[model samples]
Target: MQSLSNRLQTQPDASTATALLQLQAQVDGDPSPAPSSDLDGMSLGGLKRKRCRGDFEVCALGGEVGRDVVERGLVTGEEAALYFGTFFQGCDKYVPVFDPSYDTFDSIRRRSSMLFDTIITIGCRAENGAVSSQYQALSNTTKSPIAEVLLGTTLPSIETIQALLINACYSEKGWMLTSMAVRMALDLELPDAYTQLCEIMLQGSDNVERERDLFRKARVWFGTFVLEHILSLDCGKRPGVRADGVAMRRCRVLLGSSARTTLDFRLLAQVEVCELLSSGDAGADVLLALAHDRLSPRVGVALSDRELGEIVQGTRIDLSIWLSDWITLVETAGATEEEKASLVVNLKIQRDWSEMTMLCKGLQGIGIDNVAIMSEEQRNLIRLAKISAQRHMSTIMSNTGLYLGGFRYGMDFVWAKCAFSVLLLLKLTRLLPESSNMPQLIADSKVLLAELSKVRGLNNIYFRILSLSVEKCERALKEDLAQAANPQNSGTQLNFPDAEMEFQSYVPKEFILEWSFPGLTFCWIPFDFQDLLMDFGSGL
Candidate 1:
């Protein structure tokens, strides 16, 4: 009887070995043994085993696994712990989705490879040489998996959406990743997740684990929504996710619960700010209509210059109201002093950027030649843009030590907006050279851009392009100054034949082109000057 029992055990082991051989053969594309009933019985729960040989083959060819556990080989446990700590310390506050107290490196890595790799990639921004090297290595290793997720080959999950949002903040593929993330968030029905959580709470459910999971999904959706609007403003496009009042209210209700933390307050503040920016008054509606007209050129009734001026005035009032409300919220937000300070500076930059964007929109189709004939409204808009740009640069400069030093705790779009403010100052200087303070503002902006370009983590392609443009603007400004100081340098006289000719020839096309970075949409530039801003430094 003992011998018989041993034989039966050996039979099961032999059948399992045969099944393993069959799976290996399938993966290797080799002929395998014929089907056997024993293999069927060996299947888990009597279900047919699913084959994932192709996935393994793809990963093998790409030299990295395409699953959550894939990081086990590429990132050591120690490295992952270090990255997780670094990311939570510096980067997570801005996004404020992950809870460092609750989520561990192993838990996140086991949940989603994309999120884990993204966190590591952003964490690698540290100044240490070892961390920098690891960043490059981790970035390379994660690219294939990220591409696979983006391509929809992998299943969509809340973690993947969060990863895409985080990636959008820093990666060059921001717009693309954000669009994908929005689509995925919708696909996963994330917005409704908040409502469901609310319902669950109303039912007095005591399932803490389920409540936590739903809360996480809700947070991810909110993060994605807020980021979409921010990026849309940055890219001069409309946001994909519309603000839902019901969802926002539910989120607020959750915020008042025991689970609320300081990061939740920051997230709520961002959501409210974005919503206010997107919700404009009558003046904003008119500007939007004009933008639409510019894009399509339909023969619609045009508003008089005076009417446009009224719109600008209304828009400025709306901005003031928004700022007042924001200030009130910041004062009463109940966050720590450090957190409140960081939030204020970051939001102030964004607020100034929104104003500049609106003002620039008003200047669309009005070129250098039309400056003299511009109505008071047009000139007022230019003045507002100039002031906004100055304030934007000043805000950035004031916080230079905070933003540029350490881990550089702001989004890529924030820096892009800062660079755009510099370009706007240059553009405004070109438009109104007689403004007494314009030269000093332009010079200060140039110095700021130079400093930004020198920062290791903040030096991106947008900053590099801005740096080049500012350099050229400085040279042009110096030449103009030199000409003003000594007018008898054998060149043409100071007086011009006509305003049109002088305006056309004031800044050579080369200098304007030097200011442009092709395919880069940092902020709104006038449609007429698009060609002037073509990529002049292609070789560079």
Candidate 2:
């Protein structure tokens, strides 16, 4: 029989669940855990059992979990539901009290609704911890007791189980969750479903930002939790992992030493991109860590200004090389332009988080500054994100193809017009010849422009860029560029339409500009476009 302590040692996921259950079945009294249904034992399952090697690998988290318990005859209708019901509001006392005949997500959620009702009665105080210690306590108990129930083995200490779960809930991102951090911790697996009772307890949380952040955090934790659940499915002693160290060490995988080197930044090209679009910092932080550590060859995180400077010096800026790598990464899913756009946008946001912090500190220390100078490097990051988005768009559009995913050339392609102005803004920002020799940025922007201007370079829409640059120069650039003392506060974009007479100097036609900013859609008049709005607002 496998010891409870041994099962907690691996990276848990769906694959590991089967192993965990086999141990549970070996106990003399575990009356098969499977439940019967109207279809006479015909249940469509995600994973198929192979060789029926273990005793009981059941978990309430889905996949192999619901299976082994039913086959082993350990739970029945009311007993199973009552047993799994505790995770919900009023249901917490229910699941532990009665075993359920069958396992279903809908049933689990209902149990949660009961729990929800209870929380409401006590002023909903139980909802305070996003990641609760209460849930963690439940999880630690379940993974181990499960071993005892099936394998007839001695149980693990309560403290050891608690520590394993606490670490599991410790999200890779440094989101200082509320003490004992319950919200994130709730992702842990036990033997039942409690979602419904929980949802009722959580009312009116429909905020956009909140939902987005919540989803992101869920993805990361769910991935981690599932992996652990699967690993615990192992059948033998010290089952999941040979040791727990393997899983723990994987969490803090390091980036190379070059991550600490200073970047000249002059050799680096730049782009300004939107901040990550997640609802909260927790999810964004996790995504950022993934991008920094997993996506790039040289990963960095939370570097100080000096460290950032060292990184810039150590790294080489070869746009073709870097873009190739980035584009390839973005194209992996073969997703549509819209989907690709969303993912790319996320990728940019993560990159910005990883790189912008230290860049901001470095620029704030410029010699002649009375006020904090907005880091050009940060601006470059934003610019980089925009161009990066534009560059992959065609490849994205190409891969999804026009027929399958609503790929019409008119309205669908109209979004391209908006993207053009964004890229132009980045190019002009890079072209600004400030005292700092950021020629690399300018050169990089030019390369990006070559890609964007595929429409014979005719996308001249805005007046400011033409007004700013005297002439386009590559090496020994002569145009003087002024740095914004507080670029963060500057307006990089204005609602400038081609027809507005008030802004007649900016357009070829004056009378056409009389309509409202929102009414520009129907303005059918056409005119020669030039420098276009040279830059999209700011970088990161």
Candidate 3:
């Protein structure tokens, strides 16, 4: 099995290959490199002496101690390139500076140690751990002196993006940092190069050399576009670029031939997903799309039951097709076992989330007051919702220790998914059959949250909110169970106009399912459910 570095070292871009050869020659020409003392401001012995325990123990080991860690789930080339493309696109000059092969101390002559150190710090968080202590260790390592330096520096364009990506990668708990990263990327004028390429392409250039340069530029712009779109969706913020933006139009050029590989394909698919969300073609997840708008302008947009059902069904079909093609392409592209597993888990979670969203939309439309006297179809929706939540939880559990030595690619996002699944399960426990294993599911979710909390940091306010939400859920469940035991006691009327409001308020506001960034900043604003929440509050 070729290593991530090796795979990245062999990525198919002809220009990248030539540049690497040249970079290798330049490094080789300098026989006497900087002294170790001056290089990272640490002696070789001192560098080896600093170590990390807990979830990141393997990564912090010495030549002997870290040998197993390095051999096992090292960062993949694709991950490195993805991050690179995500933030450093259009600026080819900074490519080698942040390239993965230069990740080691041995390759630290030209590159910044801050960059190298940041990768290790974030990578450590994804390490598979058997206990919370491992996660604790991972969190603490981010506070290391070296990491502190990198975190605090105001690097230039390329390094700024590099630093921002690291910050976003490590600070996965909240949208604040991620949103900040998006904002910073825009401020640096990162996407401007791609815009220029678009102009050049349309100017009628038959020059093959210029065409290749244009292709590269278009890809870079697309890379930045992908980052902006995904982060925008995740943060519930408006995307910097619109669906009909120049970047999207130029990005499709890849579909002509440049997108045959898995990475490019994923990028293209993500672009489409972003466009769908932006264009409000989100199918069953239309509520989420409207929420991302931040204004809740579509709150009044009404679809009849049949129309909504058709939309949901259409979405499911589209996602099914995308998922199927994604799987086949990844397998056919010769991705490693680890890569395949990671991608599959992420995809399955996406599917489950979609199902849950559809279920939620249907439930909201029906209103809680109607749930007690729901039609067969409504009951069926509840069943599917429970199954979807369960599938999401099960998939998450199966992939819990995915970071062990493999790529810790999506742990932060996975944490968010786990939180979402747990909240859904808590809500479903109220509606599902009493014999359902909801109690056990809820217990497992709490444990998962506890573990994730340790990794996110003690100061992470989002996890604290999640913990409180879980408690509120448990309390609500107990109260309901007690009420169920005393059937003779009079409760609120089944057809009361206010029943839905009561139900919405029953689930703690914290568990309201906003994908805001990590940490405490009272500035978090939620919109998708906002209109519904406001309507209920206003007695509508």
Best by lDDT: 1
Score every model by TM-score: 0.71, 0.25, 0.54
lDDT per residue, candidate 2, 1-540, as tens digits? 222223343333343233334433533445665322211112222222222224533332323333323233433444334443422322221011211222233433343322222222111112222134443433332343233222312222222222223232222211121111222133233211112212322454445444333332322232323223212211101112221212211111111111110110100111101011011111121222222222223334444435544443322132233334444545653446654554444344323332332222233223212111225553453334334333433333333322112211111112222332333332323333233334544454454344334422232332223222212323213222211344454334442232231222222121122100111111112222212322323331
> What residue runs in model 2 are displaced by over 4 Å at the alpha carbon?
1-108, 114-308, 313-326, 362-540
Ranking by TM-score: 1, 3, 2
Which candidate order results from sorting by lDDT in descending order?
1, 3, 2
lDDT of 1 by residue, 280-392 (tens): 33222112322323322225645566765676676667656655655566667778877667767755665676566666665653432245556677776677777877787
Whole-model Cα lDDT of every candidate shown, in order: 0.57, 0.27, 0.46
Better of 1 and 3 by lDDT: 1
Better of 1 and 2 by TM-score: 1
The C-alpha stretches of model 3 lying farther than 4 A from their native spots are 1-156, 172-224, 245-269, 276-301, 358-384, 403-414, 432-436, 443-540
The TM-score obtained by model 1 is 0.71
- Please provide the root mean square deviation of candidate 2 (C-alpha atoms, Å): 22.4
Model 3 C-alpha lDDT versus the unseen true structure: 0.46
